[model samples]
Structures are given as C-alpha cells and as structure tokens.
Target: MVVGELGSGRAGSTESPPPDSAAAVLAGLDEQQRTAAAAVTGPVCILAGAGTGKTRTITHRIAYGVHTGVYTPEQVLAVTFTARAAGELRGRLSALGVGGVQARTFHAAAMRQLRYFAPRVLGGPMPELVENKLRVVAGAATRNRLTTDRASLRDLASEIEWAKTTLATPEDYPARAKAAARETPFEPAAVAAVYASYEQAKSRDGSLDFEDLLLVTAYALEEHRDVAREVRGQYRHFVVDEYQDVNPLQQRLLDAWLGGRAELCVVGDPNQTIYSFTGADPDHLLGFADRYPDAEVVKLERDYRSTPEVVGLANRIIGMAPRRRGLPGLRLLGQRAGGPEPRFLEHPDEPTEAAAVAAACRALVDGGLPAAEIAVLFRINAQSQVYESALADAGVPYVLKGGERFFERPEVREAVLLLRGAAAGRDDGALVPTVRDVLASVGWVEHRPPPGGAARDRWQSLSALVDLAVDLVAEQPTLDLAGFVTHLAERANAQHAPTVQGVTLASMHAAKGLEWDAVFVVGLVDGVLPIAQSLNRPDAVEEERRLLYVAVTRAREQLTLSWSLSRQPGGRRSRPRSRFLTGIAPESTAARRTPAARAAVVLDGAAGQLFEALRSWRTEAATAASVPAYVVLGDATLQAIAETRPRTLTELAALPGIGARKLAAYGEDVLATVAADT
Candidate 1:
C-alpha cells in the first residue's frame, strides 16, 4: 500500500513516532518548518518565500520521513530544476546522515526511468540523446524547402521544444501554436512543417533530444502498466522543488511516477514562477490543493536572505502583480537587521549607468565587502558589454556567470584537445611549435574576419588561445605541454572557474538561487526589463515582473535598481524607468552622477593619467593585433594597474586580467607605461 493512501487525515496522530536521528534534523526549524517536517505522511504544499530556508525545510522533511519509518531513503524521490540544486539536495541529505535519497532534476529522474524501462517495454535500448537539435532542425528546414535564417531557425527550434514538452505532436503543432498565440517569427504552418521534418530526422537518427526524455518517459508510464508499477515500487515518496516552474511534460512525468498514489510534497512560490516562455505553467503549483484535496498548505514568509528594507521592496514589487486564487500575495517579514533602503538611480545613458554601477561595486569592495560577494544583474545578456567594459576599467575582477565558460567554448575545447594530444609526446622545446601546429590543425586562420559576425568572434577566441599558450610557456619556462594540459583539465573540473573569483555579472534568470551582499539590477529601462518581445503578451509581461522580483530579492544587504534615459550620449531621453517601478517611491533614495556622466571625465591624479595611457596602448595594440580592446587587456585590468601602480614587469603581470598570453604580448609596454608615469 502507498504511504499516503491511508486517507488525508491530520498529520502525526496516526503516524509512528520519529526516531532519534530526526531530532537533530528538526532542531533549528521554526514552528511552521517543524510542522511541515512532521507532515511527512500526507501531500504537503510549501509556499516557501525567498531565503526562508526552503532547502532546509525540504531536506529536513525528507530526513524526518526516513527516520520516522514513513519512507526508506531508497523510496524517496526528490526532484529540483538544476543539476546544481539536485547535487545540493543530495549533499544536504548526506550531511543529515540519511544517504541514498534519489534527489535529481525532472529530466534526470525521467531519463533514469526511461533507461530502466525502455528495454523491457520497447525491446531495445533508448535512442541516443541529441546534443544539437537546432542544427538538426536547420537541416530539416532546408529539406522541407522552408527558407530560414539563424534567428528564425532558433525560433522554430524553440517552438518545437515547446510543442513536444506540452504533449503536442508535430501534427498538432500548427493548431497549438495558433491557439496559444505564440510569437513565432515564422508562419505557424511553416514552423509546424519544419518541426515535423525535424521529428522525422530525429527518429531516423535514432536519437532523442532533452525534451523527449520527459515526453517518452511519461508515455511509457501511461502506456505500460508494468513499467509504471516497477517505477512506483522503487520510489514511493516524491518531493518537488521549484514546482512553480514545472512545465506540463514534467507535471505529467510527476503524475506517472506517483501512479495515482497521493504520496507527494511540492514546494514553490507562485511569485517566482518566471519561465512561462518555456511553457512552464504556474497553474500546476497554484492548483495543488485542488488536485490533492488533502494536501496541507504551509506558508513560509520569514525572509532570512535580505534585510528588512530589501524585503519591503520585494513585497511591494510583487504586490503590483495581479492576484488570483491559490496565488496570494505574501508579505515577507524580514528577520535580518535593517539595511539602507534599496537605491533607485536614473542615468542619462547606458555608459553613465554602467560606470556608476562599477563605481558602486568598487565602493562596496573598498568598504570591506569581498568582490565575490557583489553582482551586477541585467535583464538580457547583451546589456553586459557596457558593464563589463566599465568594471574592467575600474580594475575589478568579475565573472560572467551565465555565458559559456572560457574553456568550454567549442573552439577553445577543440584547441585544448589538440594541445592535449600534442603535449602527450612532445618535450618542452617543442611546446610552442606544438601549439602552433594544434591551432593550424583546428582551422585557426591568422587573419581577422570582417568585423561584427560570428566568424569574427570565433577568430578572436582562437587568437586568445594562441595568447594563452604563449602565456603558459612564459609562466613556467620548464613546464611541458602535458603539465599545461593537466592544469587546464583541473580548472575545468572545478565547480567555479579560475576566473570566477571576482564580482559576478549575470542575466536575471541566471542570478536565481544566488544571493549577494550587494546587487545592481541595471538596464531597467522600459524596453529592456519587461523587454520589447514580451510587450505584446500579458502573461509574458507578468513573467518579466517576476524576473524583476527575482533580481531584487537576490540582494542580502544593498540593492540598486537603475536605468538609463537614452542608449547613447546626448541622445533623447526616450526610454523611461521600468513600469514595475512605477508605484515605488523614489523619495527615500537618491541618484548620483558618475564619472561617465561628467563633461570633463576627471580621474584621480596619477591613476587617471595611467588609465589614459593604458587605454591608448590598448587601442593601438587591439587594432594592430586585430582583436577587441577587452581581449588585449580588459578595462578592469587597466584600472587595477593604474590604482595599484605596480612598479615591476612581474607586478604588472601578476594582476588578475594579465594571463600568461597577455603578459607575454603586452607585459613590456604595460610595465614601461606604468614606470614612465611613476
């Protein structure tokens, strides 16, 4: 018999006494948390707010269930969104001494189920997982005589993924796309045809994409009773984290996994449901009580992550979103000490906004906050360029968290692999020659691509690789190619990249589940935050509001919500601050002009002079080298050099941005410039 099938009675009275191990797990939990932890027998819905210890509550609940003999560690299946989150859950459970709890992402859990059930049900192994569905879709479009460009191809790919994940087949795509009022750049019929062709091709190749992992598993469970029974037998208790973000297909998988048993618990905040674009339905989370009438609803409203001031701002912003049943507005009572009211800064243009944000970061760091404890978040990835330049100039080290890691880029990976092969047999004397050979083998052309295209970007990345080799050789004159390869491998395996030790720069979506001592939500203009693409749809706009809410709540202490009046200097103040900030009072906070807003662009004495000199050298070096200035020497590195006034070549090379290749190429010029100025 399923554990929760004993009828939806009140928690604990009918249950067995929990073991001694559960006492340690339940020690620090608040009344609400303790109650939720104890309600291990029935369906529980935790409306956990930001930083209210949702992870803590859920992990404890799982541990409590195991200790109380309600469920074994092997019988509990906990699913979250990301691999990082899943790993964290497993780690927490391990720390609590309850190991073997099957904590995984929805896709991971489904994939495991599919692998186990496929051979028995389908009489064959599961199809190979497709790594690049977009490429396959592009090919399919060509075969179907559907003319498409890169952007349209991407849209078509997304539509296909959305269709499949929503349980719609290719035949149903055109109708579904039209009915949903999806903003597809291509005709619905044309996209549907392309999707059809893409599906056929995937079948022909005997492979499945990421979306197929969940769709196929759900299908198997519904169609095959034995498969479903076997899965249910193995894992009986289910706990889902971030249930608000569950797309329809995942919900189907969850249902299939439960197999009519009500032994499940889900935790989410409706206000944090921001992935509607990917077909994630907040309705599932909102309608949990109705679905499982006996489900106990627990609201966790104590804000532990942010100060009272920051929490107040979050509560106010979320209140602006229209309310509905099951999705009530939660007013977080901040438990942390009071902090300064979140700042609302209005700038004349993007450059000034970026500079001010950089300056703010610098001030925070200089005032004793670690650089790693600060972040600059924006609505979109494109908005990071200006801030990246500004931060580089300010001598700040920062990591762009959401983008492709430096070593993970396709070109970089290929080059590294080639280098690894060459290093295996080569001696130190042949290292430079081996590096040159590896670049050539990997199609590295010496000449630059005509500016502003993917080709140019690839060329720059390849060029950077060459610079990397040169730097490595210089740093360790005796270190062979094998040693360098080992270093690269070690860096890749580490969770945080070597370069991620500085201030974090990330898009709002990527900044979720992460908190900082200070955060700057920049590019908050009308067209950017709600974003122009989302303007036509109300639901999309609401998701954007939630995105902003996510950004605001990421701050633990200081918060600055900023926007630029114009895109360029002396341009008209066409854009206004985001609509979400409309009812928010600007009285308590003040805007200040940064150096970028000044008419004269003053810098402090020697540092200012050094900055100018470094910029001049950078411009010349970049042009001659046919690469972006940032590639030659990031603004942050120059800023550090100017402020620190490193006296020797070694000192200059030791700065954060100056890698081995950089030190080899520009080390002499940088040291001379600094020495001459001093």
Candidate 2:
C-alpha cells in the first residue's frame, strides 16, 4: 500500500530506498524524484506541471516498487484518463522490466469488472450495450416532437454526457443546468424532457450506455460487500493519472474502489485544468490534503521540455490568473538548455496573420526543422480556413487535427450552398452587406453564443466566412457573388491535396498532452482566446488562462504568439492583443502614453512600444541594483536600440553606449525585451 501524509517539503536523501536487481531504475532521478520513488508512506499526490517528466517519475516509482517487492506486478492497477496514455504507461513499465500490471482507463477497468460481475449479480446474460449513444439521443429527440438538426443534436449529446458525468439525474437536469449557468442547445425544459425520454428508451431496450459502466460498477461495489472485498483484494494498489480532471462520478468510483483504504497516488497539475465544460475540477487535486488528511504531496516543478524563455513566459501568464494567490509552487523552473526567446507578431488583419504564420512555418522547415515536428494551434477550429489556404498557397503540407478540414464542416457546407444560391439571382449591391445577409440565413448571430456550447462553435465557423468575404471584397471591390463562389472552390480544391507529411493544425484543446519542436499559437485577440462568452465569468476566464498555458508549454524549442488588430486591412485598430499578454503586449493593458512619457523624438508604432518597454525594464533593473537608470541605458540609447531593434550582439554593439563591456553585461536582456515587443 502507498504510505504517508502532507506538507513535508523537499524529500531528503537521508533515507535509502530498498534495493532491487533492477536498481538502475532509480538512477538519474533528481532529488525530488528520488524522494517520490522511495517514499513508502500514505497516499501520494504529485503536482506535476506541463513538460515535467511526471510520466517517467511515476513509472520509475512503480517499477521500483515491483523490484523491491513492495508491490506485486499482478496486483497493481494504473488508471489513466485516456487510452493512449494508458498504453504508454504499459509500454514504459515493460521497458523497466516490470509487467503484468493492469493499466487502463476508468471506463475500461469498470467495464472489465462489469463483464465479470454483471452475469453473477443479475442472474442472467449482460444487457446489450448501446452501440451509439448519439443515435439514441436523436431518437429520443424525435419522440419529444423537437425540431432538431445534426449540430444541435451533437450539442445535446454533449450536454447529456456532462449531466451524467456530474451525477445529475434527468429529473434534476433543468435545475442543474440553471445552477451551472449552462447554455443548452434547446430550451431547458425541452432538454430535460429529451433527457428523461432518452433514459426511458434505454431502459426499455435493456441497454446500457458507456457512462453506465462507471455508475453500475460503483453501485455493485457499494451495494454488495462481496464485490467490494473482491475488487479491493484483487487490486491492492491504485495510481490515477490526470487526477485534476476527475468529475464527481469518477471520484465516486475511486472512493468505492478504495473502501476507506489509502493505496492511491494521483498525479496532476491544477494550473493545467482547462476542461471545465466537461466538469473537470482542479479542486480534487488542490484539496487532496483535506480529503485524505494523511496524503503526501510532491511538487514536480522542474520542466524538462521547454527552454527558460518559454517557461518564464508560461509562468507570467499563469501568475495573472484569478485566485492564483492561494496556490504556490505552480511556477516552473526550466531544465533544458536555453533556446530562442518566443516571438510576438502583430498584423493588420487575420489574413495577414495566417499568411505570416504559414511563412514562418515554411522558413523553419527550410532551415532544416522537420515539417511534422511543427504545429499551428488556435483558440477554435473555425480559425483554420485561412491557415489552410495560406499553407496550401505557400506549397506547405498540413493536416487538420481532431476532425475534417474546415471546408468539410456541415455548417460551412450549408453556408456555401446558400452562397451558391445567392450567386444566381440575389447577388447585388455592396459585397459585405450582401454576404452578411446570406450567412445570417444560416444562423450567424450578431452576438456569439456562450462558451462550451455548440452554438458558439457554429457561430465561429460561420463568422469566419463573413470575415473572408470582408477580405475578398476589400481586395476586389467590384467582385460579385459569382466570383467569390469561384474563389471558394479554388481554395477547397487546394485544401484537398494529400497531406501526410505536414504540420498539425488544431485548437488549443486538441493540442494538450502533445509537444512540438516549433509551435505558433495564433489569434491572440481579446474575444478569441478568453472568448467573448467567458469575459464576465471569472472562473471561465481563469480556465481560458489555463488553456493558453497549455498551448505555451507545448513547444520544445521555438515558440511564437501572434494576433491581428482587425478582421480586414484598413479596418479599425480597436482589436488589442489579448489582455492575458498584459503581458509582453503592454498596449493591451496600459493606458495610452502620456504626452510627457512619449519620446521627445517621434518614432514609428513598433519602435515607440519597444522604447517604452526598455525604459520600464531599465527602471526596474536600476532600482534592484541601486544605480541610476541612465547608468544602464540613457534615453538616447534606448531610443536608438528601439529604432534599430538590434537582434544580435554585433547589432547592439554598433549602437551608442553599447560596446563589448556593456554587451557582456546586458546584451541578451536587451534583445529579449526587444523581442517581446515584436
């Protein structure tokens, strides 16, 4: 069994771990890791941040347990949150000379138990499980006389899963949805009716759904003492990965399995909890101390994946999130050798942003970075159309991640159909106004729907087309509907190219748990990343911050963050960079520069911003060293540095007040701060 309790900082080397023939498993582990692997005490909680070798540490700990005879390989069960993660665990353990340990997802393990116990408990064969839960949900919607379509049906199915996973019964779904401020696809009562009818249909067919595996297994364990004793005896030790994502029902299953024992070690990071819509709660990991009272918590903050620049940027982003004061040790100290400071790019419009990102990816590939090792991640899937076209136009290969290409989406297809019809007779007048009416026919709302709902996602996809129309019209003012339709066809044909050896294009959510050698996180405007739906909600905004943190930590070396000021060129410059970047993007948060603060020497936009940042950095640096600000950089040199934006030591040395001695003291700092303003 896992042993120990909370709050003892930094594991000391005073105690030696038990020896094993496979003792080499403990070698190369850092002090904190060695302590975690050797601790033979109560339930353990590993606060593993992104890029930290939490997976390696846990595997070695388990392998050490087996080698030392503290654990029998056959009796240990490792539960992960995904099938891929579980497979990796088994593979890692096998490489460590440990085998026969059962590694499975919660659903997989419970389903196995149900296969064994359902027949005996029911005195008959198991009920036939539902092959497609969405089909059942659609059938139930038909029974309720509801007018439904494919997208809304998908949204309803997702809401049903949330309700079920959070343990809310159909009778209570309406109240629960209200309590959670959820935006259901249908009216609340209608949603509840469909949910109730769906449950009835399942009961009538004698069919169990996927979610039923967790509920039934836990019920059996709680109702039957024999089943509890059997499961507890068979698997004497349990280790749960991604514990931050455990919902109420999963936690219920975990509690039933434990039966008041403490043979559990849960590894997770509260800072990376971004799946709140699916009911993932960070508190489960945050409050581990209160739950077990005797749990041992280890903070795994050494990040071996990213360079110092990347880790430092990630830390600053999370530091500004709400309720951050309550959590400590969330900071990550980089372990890898230094790499390039992350680049921040600004563009006049989204088309420019997408094209610039594509050009950057192409340049990286041309510089000898493998194409497959690069990725372009955005806030939503709808933002991919421009990138797809841009990459195809640049002769760069790419793949759409998690789903079909943008032009293949159902809503996009319908909107394109409407646009085709408009080309025949309705095409007239100003192009932008005429196109907006066409898209509005397909449910493009003036205000976007709330976050975590299908309506918002559908809106994003449709709205992208409207923005496309804006860009197209600005480029060719006389172009009518027929010409735009032809343009769409050309772009779609280009996107259809065979795309196996290319960069990955995914939303921030899909990019989690995966790393890239070079990552470009685009669309860093206010309404996109935090999303318009989450602005007023503090909790939701915090989750958005966590999502950005996830995106930042995905890079192994080169990382770039970018945003556009408007949807089209010559448009208003009202769209500031994301406030989360308050950032390296100070213009996103600070007030306009006072007339007095402005450089007496007028400079261009980019140079002006860089000069202010350098001055700010100089003020702080001077105070820390008890020196005059000019002792580091006079205003004239700061302005010169900003105007030239020197990238290398030679460039800085050519400027005033910068020689070999000064470059040795402050060259890298000047370069990095200048890079931030780009």
Candidate 3:
C-alpha cells in the first residue's frame, strides 16, 4: 500500500514518505506523490498542473487502495480515456504489485458488463457492435437515397450518439435537435426518423454501435434494480482518468456501478476537456466537490515535467479565463524554475515552418534530448503531413497518427468486412462492401507499390488471398459476409497491428495523457489554436485554452512553441504570434526591449498608464509600425515601462531582455517617441 509523505519544498531527496500500512503501497514515489497516493478514501481531487506526476498519482493510488485493504483487487474499476492509457495504467498497476483490477476504456468496460448480462437481462444473444459507424451511416444514407458526404455521415452518427447519451429517444429527438448549440445537416424530424430507422435496422441485423454499448447497459441497470445492485456489489471502488471528458452516459454508468457504496477517486485536469463537441463535459470534473460535499480536494501543485518558463506562460494564458461565478479550486500556480524559454518562432510559411520545426527537433535530440522524448503537435490531423515530410527528409524517425493514410488501409478494412459479411447476412446491402473488401484485402487486384520490393511482395500475397476469398464468396451467394470478415479480421488482427519506426506525430487532441521529454507545439495562431470554430463560444474558447494547456503540459523538459506567417510561403501578410503569448508580457531581455530599470522614480496607477502609452509608442516607432491601441501593449510590457521609463536609447539598450537586434531596429524611434510623449 502507498504511504503519505508530507510537503517539504526542497527539490528531490528532501522528504521521506510515511510508513505504509498493509493496505497501502507507496514505492517509486517522491514525498508528494506518496501523499496523494495515500489520501484515497474520500473524494480526492488531485489538481495536478503540467509536469506533475498525474499518471503516477493515479497508478499509485490504486496500489495504495489495494495494499491498505480499502479496496479489494476485484472490487476496483479504473477507466481511462483511450485504450492506450488503459493499457499503460494496467501495466503501472501491475508494476506496483497490484493485479486483477478492472481497467479499460469507458466503452470497453460498459460493453463487457452489458454483454456479460445480456442473456439473463435481455433474454437473447448479445448484439454485434458495428465498429465502423461512418460506413454504417454511409450505407444507411445510400439505402435512403440521400445525397450525403462523408462529413454529413459523420455528423449523423455524432448526432445519434449525442442523443443516445442524453437518454433521448427518437420521439424526443426533434426538440433536442432544435435546442442544440450546433446544428446538424438533417432537420430534427428527419434525423429522428433516421435514428429510429437505424435502430430498427441494427435490431433486425443483430448489430450495435459504440453508443449502444453504454446506453443499453445504462438502461438495463436503470430498468432492473437487482442488476444495478449486483453490479454495485461487485465493483465497489471506482476511479476514472480524464474525468473531465466524461459524458452524461458515462456518469450514469458510474452512478449505477457505484450504487453509493464505493468511494470514488477521479483524476482529471478540467482545462483539458476538448471533447465537448462529442458531448463530453468538464463540468463533472469541476463540480466534483459539490457532487460530494465531504470530498477532500488535494491540489497537486508541484510540476516535475516542464520548466518554470513553460509553466509560467501556461498560467498567464489561463489567467485570462473568466472564473466561473462561484467555482472554487480553479487557479494556476507555477512550480518549476529553470528551463528553456517557451519559443515563439515565426516562419515564412508552412514548408519553412515544418522544416524549421524538424531542424529544431533534430537539434534538441543532438543536444541530448531523446527523439522518443520529443513530440510535434498541431491543431488538426491534416497538419501532420508537412512535419512528416520534413522530418523524413531530415532522416529523423517519426510516427504519424491517424493511420498511414486512410485510403492505404482499404485492404485491411476489406478483410474485416468480409468476415463481418457472414454474420450480417447477404440481404444487408451493408454486407456487400465487406465481401468486396475481402477480395481486395487478399489481392483480388494490383495495388500501387510501396517503396521497396519487400513491401511489394507482402501486398501481392495479400492481394492474391483476397482474390481467392472473392471467388469463394461468388460460389456461395448466400455466404454471410459479416462472419467471413470477422474470421479474416481475427486471423489478421494480430499480424497487421500498426507500428511507427520514427518520430511520433499526432494531433494535439490525440497527445493527451501521453508525455515526452521535449515537445514542439506548432501552428499556434489565432485562427488555428483558438480554432476559428471555437472562438465565439466561451466554453469552446476555454476548451481551446485547455488544449493548449494539454500541449504545453506534454513537454516534460524542453518545450518549443512556433507559428508561421501564412499557409503558403509569401502568399499572405505576416501574422503575429498567438495572443496567448501576450499573456507572458515583457519576454526576457534577449527577445524584447523594455526600459524599466533605469528610472529613479516610481509611477502610480495613472502615471503607470501614461508611461505605458509612451513606451508602447516607442515600441511602435521602433517596430516602424503604427502605435496600436493600449490593449495591444500587454500588461507585462506596460508594467516594465512604468518601472523603467527610459529617457534615452542607451538606457533602453542597457535594460534587461533588450537585445542588440531589437535596439538597432527600434531603439532610436522608440526613444524619440517616448521622449516626445513625456
């Protein structure tokens, strides 16, 4: 079992952990980590900022609970945001000598329980899960003869998932659709019709979608008190990771599972809730204290991951977020002291930006950081391409997320579909693609060759096998495409697991809960980072900030933040750095020129305001640009000017953070402007 270690501000080696009980295990943790681990009985909210050992706390918490006998090995249920996180948590638990605990993605956990009780509760066999919702939507749309693009199909699926989670039936969907913040392509009535039809089709074909896994289970528990009691009896301790991203349906599942008997320990950074569009809410994470008034809130403020520079910048940006009217426990406190300044490099355009990022990554590694320690993050999946090309050209190893390319995986998907065909039956037109995919998967046709002859040979063999499957399917017209596809998938799944041989490339959204030694946050522009779509909604804007917060936190040691002037080289005007950077105000002397140290006199509030205006004018003249509004001059720079109102250019140059490049470029103009204003 984990033991508690009280706070001692000394860095490493300063504090010793408390002695462990039979129920608590606290090995491999420093003082603070041990404290967090031991405090598991009450609702403990670990407000772990960036670089803090959040994952460690969660893993050790589980170990402590088991060791202390607060929770039995079989009684704990741990949920993570992704399958990868779930796996990592399970490994960590085992490493701590705790095993046989329940750990899985939220969907996986719900699906397991639902299927286990299907025979007794539903009085029938378990329903098949349609792994690919996009395809299902497309086929359904085709059947309805509705002209819809892939985006529309995805929208329909999302709408259905949202409705299902909200416990809205087809009869209740129209009003909900109209009241939703974001509109879908189909009208509310038509969407309700489509949802009803989709359910009917799935029921007839014995299929279930991802949402159904949670919804069906929630309904079963709510409808049958005995089952709910049984589940609560079995899993008495509940822990959820990325708790901020929990949707309503997930909360219901947890509520039913806990049955008020289990104590809850949920760890999540509310600022990292970026899945609101998918019905996830940060409110649940933020409102934990209110949900359980007796809960003990633990603020894990020591950040062991990022340097002071990165953490400082993150805190400043977050400070701009409006505090919820009555919400407590929402604040930023920086911990680390020494590290590289969070860079804000500007490039000519995307290619140059990509090349610069790749070069910087290489430099970081050569400078002693591991390639594995570095991650290149962007706003969207599409942004991974340039980095991949630039990094590959630089002979750097990198992994690309979102798959090698969707079109390139046709063979694998086809093979799975063929197996699925057997179970789905031939009458389901949806099963046709499965058979065709199988034909393509085993080599019914020639594919565009990959670079080497070795890859070519593998593709050819797979193609030939697919051709055989197609011919066999043709011979037996009534063959079930679904079942055949499933068989093929099971056989190939193990062999075809994807791998990356180089640098890891993924969207910012995909990088959460994972950490690296060095991280490059690219494309930090106004329209991109705040994301043009998220700008208007205060909640979305907060989520965007959380996304940036997530990206910054990912950098364990070295963090590089960069942006470009335009999408295409020299096509658009030079864009400024993200406004979030302004929060840092008066960057160190190396990158900025501020005159605050030379003054023999101090300025009051009104005087400070005037001094700032004069300094801003000086900056404007030195930049050889129009002196914009007072708002453009950040609080830091303004404060610096108030502290050091330089009467001369020489004094300005002598000031901290003012570099020669800045002096020569803007010195005379700034000095003259400030002098004239005074």
Top-TM-score structure, candidate number: 1
Candidate 2 per-residue lDDT, tens place, 354-406, comes to 76667566656666787768999999999999998777655566766887577
After TM-score superposition, the amount by which residue 21's alpha carbon in candidate 1 deviates from its true location, in angstroms, is 1.7
**Greater-lDDT candidate between 1 and 3:** 1
The C-alpha lDDT values of all candidates are 0.77, 0.78, 0.65
Q: Can you tell me which runs of candidate 1 are displaced by over 4 Å?
A: 1-19, 405-499, 587-678
- Give lDDT tens digits, candidate 3, residues 1-678: 212200112222112224463335665666667777888785776666555678888888887877766666777778886766776777677767777677778788887788778887778878888988777767666766678888888888888888887778989889876665567777777777778878787888888888888778878888888778678777777788877788888888777677665388877766667788778867888888777777766656667767777777777777777676312543444566687666554444677667656755655554556565679999888888888877765545565655543224565555455455545555454334554454554554444534432454345444444454555467666655555554445335223233222357888888876778778899877888888876777777777887887888787667767676568744563555566666453332212323232111112334345555665565555455654433333333333334345666655544433457767865676566566656
Q: What is the C-alpha RMSD of each candidate to the true structure, in Å?
A: 11.1, 17.1, 15.3
TM-score of each: 0.74, 0.71, 0.69
- Model 2 misplaced regions, further than 4 Å: 1-19, 324-327, 404-500, 586-678
Which 10 residues in a row give candidate 3 its minimum summed lDDT?
5-14
Residue pairs in candidate 1 whose N, alpha carbon or C atoms collide under 3 angstroms = 392-635, 392-636, 393-635, 393-636, 471-660, 471-661
lDDT of 1 by residue, 570-661 (tens): 77765767898888845312123343322112134555578788888889999998998778976646765665566666556545566778
Give the Å shift of residue 486 in candidate 2: 47
Candidate 3 ranges with C-alpha deviation above 4 Å: 1-24, 27-32, 171-178, 186-190, 325-327, 330-337, 365-369, 404-501, 574-576, 585-678
How do the candidates rank by lDDT, highest first? 2, 1, 3
Between candidates 1 and 2, which one is better according to lDDT?
A: 2
Worst ten in a row by lDDT for model 2: 4-13
